[model samples]
Target: MDKIIYAILISNDRQDELTRLLSGIRGISDSNLFNITYNDISVVASDFSSNKIIVDKEFAIDYARVIEDLAQHFTLLPVRFGTLMESPDAINEILIKYYDEFKQNLQKVENKYEFSLKVLWDYEKCSGKIRLKTESEDQNAAKLFHNNSVSTEYLLKKIKEHRFESALLEHVEQLIGEISTRLAQLNPIHKFQKMVTPNIILDAVFLLEKHKKDEFIQAIDHLKSQHDDLNFLLTGPWPPYNFVEITLK
Candidate 1:
């Protein structure tokens, strides 16, 4: 049987306490959860028969819930869904091998919680406005294409559209800058993905100190007030899923 790993946690000198905590929470397939420890760190895992494991959305969520519960009291690196090993000794070998890196990462996230922010806008409305602005700015662009061959006209149109798209991206970057500026006071470690979709202009995640969560929410609420044209969807105080920087081979 393979054991599915949920998280890597710092048990410190609290193995007994960690044991008590695991006793109360069930893992995937309602299996009893337990820890395999080496020194100060441990792996939360449950018995999972590889042939019987169902890789489905429900099971994935159950896996995350187990990690979520562990993260409530321990600073942990959540294991990716479907991670499995043959034995506790194998798990112990990994912990011994990666002890320093794991300890460093645990220190990095010691008291921090992760939050996500997505900025959305009306695609048609925003693009329409941008097109108008681009046209107004480039009124003389049409004159440069006076030859008027079909190919020339087509290329010119594409150029203008490219300019409009570039302008929209610049606008999004500007909004990101504003958000970063507002969040500078809180000093979070963040990552961003711009224009993930036509309507989703900004997808961002932040790792902030746990005690600063309320202030972070208030900051986002204030930011929402400033940008009437965009919708801000902020989620979490979640485990630092997006911020995990390690991969166990």
Candidate 2:
């Protein structure tokens, strides 16, 4: 049977505690969960048949659930779903090879949780306002080009479109700046994606100290109150899925 690895965690002399915890939690296909330890770190895993496993949403969710449960009890680096090895010896070899990398990552996420925030707006309404503003400004520039040739008109239109895009981008950047400034005091390690979609202006994830969870939510609430035109959807006190930066060989 192949071993499907769930997470690599800092065992920290808690071997007996970890054993008791895994005994109650189920892995994929209701398989028993166990730990393979080396020094102070351990890899959580379960028996799996690589050939027979269903590669589907349900299996993925089950895999994530096991990692999530482990995270609640230990500081862990979640293994990618479906990570399999031929035997415990292979897993031990990996543990020996990447021990330092795993230790560093686990330390970084030791007492932190991940949170997601998405800022959305009515694209049509917001873009229309920007378009109107840009068009009004363009009219002044249009007066300079007295030659009303076909190509000239087309160039002017394109220029207006470019200006509108630049302005929209500027607006998004300003918003991101404000958010960063507001959360600077909390000192979260954050990643932000701008313009994920027309409506979803900002898609962001933050690795925050677990004890500061309430303060983070309150800060988001205050931000939402200030931006009545935009919708804020904040989720998680979850495992640091986005913040983990290691790739297992």
Candidate 3:
């Protein structure tokens, strides 16, 4: 049977503790959750049968939920959705092979958690503002166009488009800058992606000490109150999915 892996946990209590935890929990397909240990590390897994309950997106998320539940009491590296092996020995070998790297990663996230902040803008409203700001310039440029000067028409048209895009991007950058400036004070490491969607102006992920969670939420609340024009969805004291940087061989 193939083995389905859940997470790699750091437990000084080692084999006995892992076995006890596995015994308390269950795996997919109602398979008994088991643990494979290497020194101080343990990966929670179970023997997966061929007629196995295949893991789909919902199931993967459910699996993540289980790991998240466990993370409350354990320091672990959440395996990305689908990490599997053939035997308990292989899982043990993996733990031995990747032990140091896993420990380093776990250490970083030991007492911290992750949060997601997605700021969505009303695209039509923002575009309307851009249009209003450029209306006169667009009108003036349109008047300069003639049938004889195709080059002028092309240049003018390009310039209008350039102006519109530049204005839009500038607005986006300004908003992102404000949020980044505020978040920087928290000293939480962050990843900021801009213009992910026409409506999504900024999607940011932050890794912060668990104790700072309230402060982070308050910061977001203040931003929301200040920018009622846009919507902010703040989710998570999530397992540090975004914070995990280690990759297993």
- TM-score of each prediction: 0.97, 0.96, 0.90
Query: For candidate 3, lDDT tens digit of each residue in 1-249?
Result: 788888888877756756766777767666788766677777888777757476588677668766886787788878877677988888877888888899899898888888999999999999889978987778887776666487887888898998898889998899888888887888898988999999999998998999999998888888888888889999988888888888765
Candidate 3, residue 96: how far the Cα is off, in Å? 1.5
Most TM-score-accurate candidate: 1
For residue 54, model 2's alpha carbon misses the true position, in angstroms, by: 1.3
Model 1 RMSD vs true structure: 1.1
Candidates 1 and 3 compared: the better one by TM-score is: 1
How good is model 2 by TM-score? Answer: 0.96
Model 2 CA lDDT for position 204: 93
By lDDT rank, best first, the candidates go 1, 2, 3
Candidates ranked, most accurate by TM-score first:
1, 2, 3
Error of 3 at 168 (Å): 0.8
lDDT of 2 by residue, 147-244 (tens): 99998999888888899999889888888788778977799999999998999999999999999999999998898888888899999978888877
lDDT, model 3, position 55:
59
* Model 2 worst lDDT run, 10 consecutive residues: 240-249
Predicted candidate 1 versus true structure: per-residue lDDT over 1-249, tens digit per residue: 888899999999999999999999999989999898888999999999967776899998999999999999999998888888999899989999999988898889899999999999999998898888999867667877768799888888888888898998898889889989999899999998989999998899999999999999999999999999989999998998987788777
As for candidate 1, its clashing pairs are: none
